[model samples]
Target: MMMSRCDAEEDPSQTKKRKLCPSSGLPEEMVLSCLARVSRSEQASLSLVSKRHRSLLTTPELYKFRTLLGCTENLIHLCLHIPPDPNPRWFTLSLKPLDRRLVPVRSYFYQPLDAASMVAHGCGIYVMGGRIGGRASSSVMFLDCRFHTWSTLPSMGVPRYSAASGVVDGKIYILGGWADIVV
Candidate 1:
């Protein structure tokens, strides 16, 4: 049974409160609802609290609540071309209590700086249409903010990476990053 304050046998004269959290014996749904109010950066740290916390932090349900509650923050992710490195480096603007700064998001994926056409939609950054090895890249990469995971969507039949791209009406539009088309 999920524990609640009412479930506890309280001494009438005693005034003490018990800590209730996902790891502290609260119902999984309740814990997720509470945690959803917190920011993603803090949520990253909260995952270290325990095994239960770590698991709960990665659930899509938490983010769904966050979206419904309008608690989601705008995440600014930038990819800059730093010479000497073949691929660009990715960094995200981290918002913390009273202190805001850009924090590097360590990505394991290799995205070509020149050929990749990227766009930010909802909680994911879609990196698509790039030149992998001097050839058109058809791989569409998705980065989920909830868990900072890199996943692939269905591959496109043609390379569509370009400087001009956007997400309109939930659809991704790419123009000009074709291997054969030099712009």
Candidate 2:
């Protein structure tokens, strides 16, 4: 028996037709724009859709959203060297978001602080005083966002942790409960 052209194109075992492209469900441009507006975490998931979708999501335009979220081009800088004994060396890292081409910034050995916190405002990242090896500190470091340089600033009144910082007017306000209490 001879198979007809239509019969040859159709699979006898498969009743469903294969989709040419999932993109037909949504306009490519629209989908790209929507993905750009979402968070990096969300965009990461969208990139898994297919090779085409992943390509669209990796564009420079879409990747710029990471910088726009928490940092601007002018508000990013590199830091080298921390403080307080131990490993005192300078390191470079950007607080800004990054694209696939760009690498995440590294942290410098600022102080022998067990852990530190950072706040970005007015094109600068204000690192409030932290505990050095579990000891309270009064040292503060500021990075000039535009220049990518580091400098020391006035210390916080007290060493703190789990602290929050923000910009009010032109000043950085550090507010939070201290890790240690003095009786």
Candidate 3:
């Protein structure tokens, strides 16, 4: 006699359980962590392979597992200035680990700059004065990573370009740069 595809053939002598994931032989939670590390682009293809993959890929619990595993994803932000366009445009690209696929994000900072000093504080990227039309600039711009917006901060004492800047203990420090001082 032949059984249907959905039917499970069983024997009274065989009571042992079968492994869920054939590749890893790990628990479902551990398996999810392994799957979470895969790039987002591949997750869609992997989902098509099996029902288990689809469930794990779409569920939020997989992301929770990623957090538990301390997998911190880093995003790369790039600022571009094109001629004729007055405002500088900001773009962000997300690079997936292991797979190394680039995913572009919608958010951006609306500010134009030829050269500027950038410093990261917490979740903010601060843009200090840069050279504009062969002159030093003192305009301070702040880019908030959380909301993906730009705001102006108090200008520095002097206009500087290509200045050195850093963040320490939540404080931002701006050092000497190409400043035009007429004595």
lDDT of each candidate versus the true structure: 0.71, 0.54, 0.68
Model 2, 1-183: lDDT tens digits are 112485456674443443233665654444545665664434445666787776665565444543554423322233334456454333334344563222223233343244456777765677776667676676788755433346788777777765677778887777774667668
Query: With candidate 3 superimposed using the best TM-score fit, by how many Å does residue 41's alpha carbon deviate from the native?
Result: 11
What tens-digit string does per-residue lDDT give for candidate 3 at 23-60? 45655665776776775545546767777776566566
Local lDDT at 143 for model 1: 82
- Give per-residue CA lDDT, model 1, range 52-171, as digits (tens): 887676678777878788887766677887788777877677655554666556465755446688888887788887765566777888888656668879977776556578988998
Clashes of each: 1, 14, 2
Q: Give the TM-score of candidate 1.
A: 0.63
**Model 3: residues >4 Å from true position, as ranges?**
1-73, 80-88, 98-109
Better of 1 and 2 by TM-score: 1
**Model 2 spans > 4 angstroms off:** 1-99, 102-112
| Residues forming the 10-long window of minimal summed lDDT in candidate 2 | 99-108
Residue pairs in collision within model 1: 161-177
